[model samples]
Target: MIACSAELYCAADLLTRASLGELDVDIVAIVSDKPAAGELAAQHGVPFRLVDGGLAGDSRAEQEAAFAAVLDELEPDLVVLARYMRILPEAITVRWNGRMINIHHSFLPAFAGAKPYHRAHQRGVKLIGATAHYVTAELDAGPIIAQGITPVSHRDEVEDLVRKGRDVERTTLANAVRLHLEHRVLVWDNRTCVFA
Candidate 1:
């Protein structure tokens, strides 16, 4: 299953790959709080679930609980957070453990949270990268499964970094998902041993 926010960039790529029989997994459902995501899932013929507990008086805890319930109902073998902007609650993270994975916009251990491409551009970094890792409670510090980087020059602006970073993110996330599904990734001490 894929849980995402407004942008379905990763999800769209995964769906395309799956439709072409490139991905050897079944996408059970696409769950999100946005109708835009639902529309995307509909276009791909995947089941869509709208579980937004943040409607008016609902608390954050309620939203988390609703999301957890969606997972329980689906009971997916793997959960991929394809740009799911919200930070998952601790209970959900612990319950899912190694079964959940996420794609961060940076190479991780640096600019681990939001707007990583912007940070990379501001620092005049020569390389912008993406990280695919397990979703632990400690933000983006989970065991890294896959990463890809692209070279950038001083002339590259924030938009340029974002464009390059998206490409890396898509491929890296796909590789990570493939590795995990093939049972070729082992985690120890917050790191990964990928036999690839």
Candidate 2:
């Protein structure tokens, strides 16, 4: 399992649960570009590697090389982006394709860019949700595997929506990862059929 995020305290908790036999998966390694993230990885007792040049500034070649190095070293069957917050280059996306998964903070095709929760709120949408999908070259556009929705009341603010959306994000991502690991997801025409 790959843990990415400053608030990966959630990821750490999930990893601990998995380690305690709550989930039938092996977390081979954890990667982060932040020092605090690395500290959290250490607290979880998992080996950690730091990606070079952070996420945004790194050129396509640099980012791809860094991820490729990790893939070569870890040899994971799949790469899960647990809030890594980086737009992967097409070269890397094509290389991993269906094997790479990402969790987006919106129901997707709805708010496909940054600050999706805020966008949903600004648009006065009745519901805010999260989507889990395969990593594709085009931004958040990908084959959607699963999604979770939460009711957004008129009383809710952007922060409230974001907080609720984070819950859905974690669950959606974990569900998608589980389905992918079990070989229960099939992609067709920019969507997915999950059998579980």
The model with the greatest TM-score is: 1
User: Each candidate's lDDT (Cα)?
Assistant: 0.90, 0.80
State the weakest 10-residue window (summed lDDT) of model 1.
51-60
Runs of candidate 1 with Cα error greater than 4 angstroms are: 53-57
The CA root-mean-square deviation of candidate 1, after full C-alpha superposition on the true structure, stands at 1.1
Candidate 1 lDDT over residue span 1-196, tens digit each: 9998887899999888889988899999998877689889999999998766564567778878889999989899999999988889888999999999999999888898999988998998999899999999989988999999999999998998998889999999999999999999999989989996
Backbone clashes for every candidate come to 0, 0
- lDDT per residue for candidate 2 within 56-75, as digits (tens), equals 68765776588678877787
Which ten contiguous residues of candidate 2 have the minimum total lDDT? 5-14
Clash count (model 2, backbone only): 0
Task: Please list the residue runs of candidate 2 whose C-alpha ends up more than 4 Å from where it truly belongs after superposition.
Answer: 54-60
